[model samples]
Target: MGSWERPYWESTVDSGVPRAAQRSGAYRRYLPDAIDGMALAIDGDLSRDVAVVERKLRALNGPGAEGLAGIARFLLRSEAIASSRIEGIAPSAQQVAIAELGQSESVRGVSEQAQLVANNMTIVREATTELVVADKVAVEDIVELHRSLLPNEPRHHELRTVQNWIGTSDWSPIDAAYVPPDPDRVVGLMTDLLRYLNGAAHAPLVQAAIVHAQFETIHPFTDGNGRVGRALIHTVLARRGLTEQAVLPVSLVLATLTDEYITGLDSYRHDAAPGSPPAGMAINAWLRTFVTAAEIAVEQSQQLVSAIEELRERWTERLAEYRMAAGLRAAPRADSAVARVLVHLPEAPVLTATTLARILDVSYPAASAALDELRQAGVLATKSIERGTTAFIAREVLDLVTWSERALASTRFDTRRAEPVRPVPARPQR
Candidate 1:
């Protein structure tokens, strides 16, 4: 809403109009400076918020961070759920977990929304991992990410050639909420974006914010732009060495304030006249929102970490009681069945005796006994029993997951936590 102006060029278009040609105003070939032409000095509050978030993240990844990273799988799953929720696809944590581990029956009907959430889990994991070790983030890496998100779709790995717009069923930008610069500008703007992302032109947090907002404004892909834009948030932070092995579920917070989020993004589309003072106002607004959301994510993440640690201690106490009750003459094996199964729970919460048997490479009775012991310990509860298969729910973990996810949806948890039966596929032993 500030007096921001950006250059524009005239273009011919006719997709939504039944005419030979219609002149349209297209954003001119644009190249934003590292901070989107904004001075960092213009926003001290933003800088301070970024610092606090970074400090909390460092602490979150510190030594007290023990056992938290083990739940990185769950954190990534939470991120996927939230990212997908922003696009109006709400998949339960358990459903997404099942989908991620390549199991389907646990999720009934496998709604397109659930499937998309599952796909996002794959996209986020792949993008974050790739960016963590790469020196630079490439356009192809982004394109591949889009491809992975929208598998089997045309132009999945390519930028849009056809025109697209938001806020209307009709593809006319005339009444669109906002129009991106054009298909021809896709590569050029993307090139500019990658340059900013690669260089140390701004603080890592500021850079990450600019990268995400710019990508959203660019709307490069034919579809999956939102998911891809969100993925870039992780990529930028990872490439900048902000995060190591964890994916913060920041979108969950944004998802909770959908109206404010859209308004912030709309504010981010502001620009200034050519050769005028840099337009930092809108960038500042967006950065504040992003940073606050990230800070909340960190705080909530710490709570969950504590909850998991407490849960683990309770499991240990029960296991110790089991050891005593089992009349073991000496200490139970360090790699005892309960310990091994407990180690496996955070990775795959929903499992049956058979899957547990295979995953732990133990006999069915041994696996079943361990499961029964944990269930008796009140760690897992019976979810379902059908045709020789009995499924157990890691109820406590799901409670925390549902609390966070339902918070994102701005609603109470509707369904009970009764959910997965497979170990997540191993990453080639890496």
Candidate 2:
């Protein structure tokens, strides 16, 4: 009646540690049904934490969070960037945004690091959409997600065929921070994890915490485990119908607190050990960290939404000023460069005249004119990344995106810790 444990032969051909035990505690395969001494019971305090996180998330994607979908897209970019950082791949959010917009091939394949995050972004978004309709997560669903992220890898859509360890600097697990169940046991362990996903054994947040930590423990895939494991967090939210459209940047929050995040996973593995501690006490500690991280993620995301909305308001004022200055105060059509660029700023924080024209459905001349106006109004800044190509930077949006990630990852998790949007520069005195 022990929490599920798997056997790994020590001193085997691929064994990192030189021992002779046919089975070891490090290789225990966890199951969804139950643990020997750890039944997932929600104590009163834990219940409160779960309720708060669920309620916050429910409100974020619910009716209360209006006009946020546009800015929320930016949060998705932030998520991809921050999640990528967790795996030690740091790419500017602007580059990732350009890739996501599908307008620039220059950023594509720039480096393996950037590409991995872009792939994960695609996988997470696609998987979220899939889980919405399926109402449950399946193994095939996971495979497709993995394949999408690491299409060229040997085990792209399949489980790892060899053992994988975390925090190992070399080809040995002896000094590794954590080692998962053996490769042969990945399928069965994943099955049990999915069973828990498809069950009502716990609240959505708690179940998600267990599913994520357990997925990390199983370490099913050889590559992209961290990204996929993070994506599964959203899968749980989508399946439970908690997040209608809001993709909470939970990984961004976790990335800032690396030690706390990893420790939570370690707790998940050790606390559920047979007879180690009472089910509630150990599980409660881990769940507390999970729920708190989630709360911070949502709160910071909300602050981001507000910051974006405020930027939009400035855009509105700037547009009116431009119209009045141009003697078009009574103009019936708001089809000027100011209006067009403002609308596209949220999703496309970085753009060029050629691409801007295509996105705004306007002529090259019009897009150029709009860019000119944006530059004059301090709405967009310009940077030359390559010859004959000027990148129009949405400073407000870009600042908010990158700054929010730093803020979330640091000790400050976006709770009323606001950084005012940079104001538009006034025209020089005549």
lDDT of 1 by residue, 195-285 (tens): 7787877877778778888888878886778777877887777677666656566665666656777888876766556654345676778
Worst 10 residues of 2 by lDDT: 421-430
In model 2, which runs have C-alpha deviations exceeding 4 angstroms? Answer: 1-8, 12-39, 62-89, 99-120, 155-157, 167-176, 182-184, 199-201, 270-275, 330-341, 352-376, 382-392, 414-430
- Using all chains and alpha carbons, the TM-scores for the candidates as numbered come to 0.75, 0.75
- lDDT score of model 2? 0.66
- In candidate 2 the C-alpha lDDT for residue 181 amounts to 71
On the 0 to 100 scale, the lDDT of residue 94 in model 2 is 61
CA error at residue 156 for candidate 2, angstroms: 6.2
TM-score of 2: 0.75
- How much is the lDDT of residue 325 in candidate 2? 83
lDDT of each: 0.65, 0.66
